[model samples]
Target: MSADAVRYLVMPNPYLSDGVLDVRAVQPADIEAIRQWRNAQMDVLRQTAPISPEQQERYFAEHVWPQITSLEPSQVLVALERAGVLIGYGGLVHISWSNRRAEVSFLLTPELEKNTDELIALFSRFLDLMKQLAFEDLGLRRLCTETFEHRTRHVATLEASGFRCEGRLREHVLIDGKPTDSFTHGLLAVEWKNGQ
Candidate 1:
């Protein structure tokens, strides 16, 4: 479907915390903020150096806009506070209706990524919401993600969220012109349910 033809609807997050965050649909106005947040963390969140505004705009046109259009293309969500500050974003990618599986990824504002704070708590809550979307709302059997080896915080979060490393692709992707290894982690519905 065309990017302009796409539509979005706000959805409730089944995964709730003590009023810490609210997950809902990403609006047009939120794109610029999300892009800035993502680019600010490119060293950790992306395989490349900081992305230019043009490149980011193109990505939203060609990639993200296509995904959140509906249940078929995939899901995209933003986590906000009562004041409507965007703190994080996440989504399912490459969804397969037949296999009921997809890859997942998420990112938080750089400040919230600090390990000494409630980074783990914020992440755990987001995972619970996404897992519910996968196992119940979407009826997906599995979800997975791939992250660079250098992104230690994300790798740890994946492991702590019941995902097992399926494999590692050595020197698989480039970051700031250097090659880096990437690891794939997978989580099953059962594993999620058992709180593994």
Candidate 2:
């Protein structure tokens, strides 16, 4: 399908904590915000790779926008907004209808880390939303994610939200030119529903 021709199949937005955050499809204006968030990651062990405005615009106009527009019937790209500010984002990617599986990734603004509870709540909402789409809408049986070892906080959030660590990939990626390990996690749709 032509990239631009792919139509977005919208799903109901899901919010975990009452009156805390609102998550839904990505909009045109969200592109700049996302770029800024990614670029803002430049401290401690985690670094936000810089993205110039021109590059950001190109990415949005070329990749992200069209990907969301042509998202598979089973996939979704969501942005989390709090008090009218874009605070985080999560999405189901690489959807495989035949395998009934997808990978998920997310990021939160640096400022939100101090409020751990709220961050967890946002992740919970995203996972639940993915569960609904996988089982109810697409009838998928599995959802998966991978995280770096240093991101212990994110792993904790995922576990608290019901996903379990299944295995680890040693030297998964070269970060700062050094090999790093990654943990693979997954939650079955049935398991998610039962946990609720």
Candidate 3:
């Protein structure tokens, strides 16, 4: 791929408002930073397996950095920063060209905002990016996300941001050794545009 195509994978979405919050593509230097934050953050365990420094280092060194080029079409890694400090991160993963779908995931570095204002802003920018990626780039039909059913805060945010509850998975994941139910949410290109 040319530099232009590689650049597109990490480009910041123009729809995102610029200010204390800024989003950009993840770089080589950011790998360690993200790994450290992911390991320390309690909420991270809710989604993925508990991570260790060794695992993080090995994964990036072996898989990510080597074929960083290949990661473009399927995975877009974004870093969220506030005043030069990384406070959160989010991106679309496992982009399926045939199915026209992808999974959205994010993590806030705790102690960022007192209210959901930051979250609202975050999701607003995220959905805008998704719309652009789906409708303009990939011609995708929908995007999917999963959240704990009892996570009313997140669910409310998704609803406010135009995602609809599609279904539920019973005891889908085990967090802190406890089985947790999750709700699957989705947004179609048309629905997202209409909401805007």
Candidate 4:
């Protein structure tokens, strides 16, 4: 789709106004900062290890670019302040055209994670935007996400955003030498309310 057409298709960021933050499409320039944030968040992000700069660059070249080149299947986005500081980075991936569903993922910087109250509010707004992108912009019917069982805060965030725990894998993920269960959550299009 053309830029103007996409502009018409996307909605305004619900989180931004009166000095609040905004969520925007991720750009090439944002990669290094995003990499730093992602690596810092590895532990809370589950079964993940810190990535080297080379690996991070390769990931964008091999994984991120292909997705954006064909936006039909997926897109990556970032949430940031007008100052150009990255607050969080994530987006939908693993889209199934036949099933009209996609897997959603996101992470906040370690600093943002420390402010629980603000983090919840910021995440709630971010979730609203993700739903708009899925159901409206992408014509998708359902969205799903997964996290390690011990991530109570994130699991609760998903729940509060109307995602239900639909599946669980027992000892499916190895984290810090311990076998940890993973929970899969889902939210149907019918269950979403725009700007609500």
TM-score of each: 0.78, 0.79, 0.78, 0.81
Model 1 regions more than 4 Å off: 1-18, 47-69, 80-83
Question: lDDT of model 4 at residue 72?
Answer: 58
List candidate 2 segments past 4 Å from native.
Answer: 1-7, 10-19, 42-49, 67-75
Q: Candidate 3: lDDT of 55?
A: 81
Q: TM-score for candidate 3, please give it.
A: 0.78
The collision pairs in model 4 are: none
Q: Can you list the residue pairs that collide in candidate 3?
A: none
Candidate of highest TM-score: 4
- Which candidate has the highest lDDT of all? 4
lDDT of 3 by residue, 1-196 (tens): 2243324333334223355566565655666767766766654345365567688778766755554455246766666767677777776767786787788877766554345777667666666665675666657778888887656777887877788999989988877778888898998888876766
Candidate 2 versus the native: TM-score?
Answer: 0.79
Candidate 4 runs further than 4 Å off: 1-19, 82-84, 193-196
What's the count of clashing pairs in each model shown? 0, 1, 0, 0
Compared with the true structure, what per-residue lDDT tens digits does model 1 show for residues 1-196?
A: 1345334432234333346666665556667777778777776665355667788778778876766545466555544443456777776767787888988867777788766346777776677777777787777899999888987777887798788999999998777789889999999998877874
Ranking by TM-score: 4, 2, 1, 3
lDDT of each: 0.71, 0.70, 0.66, 0.71
lDDT digits (tens) for residues 113-146 of candidate 4: 7888878887776777778778876778999998
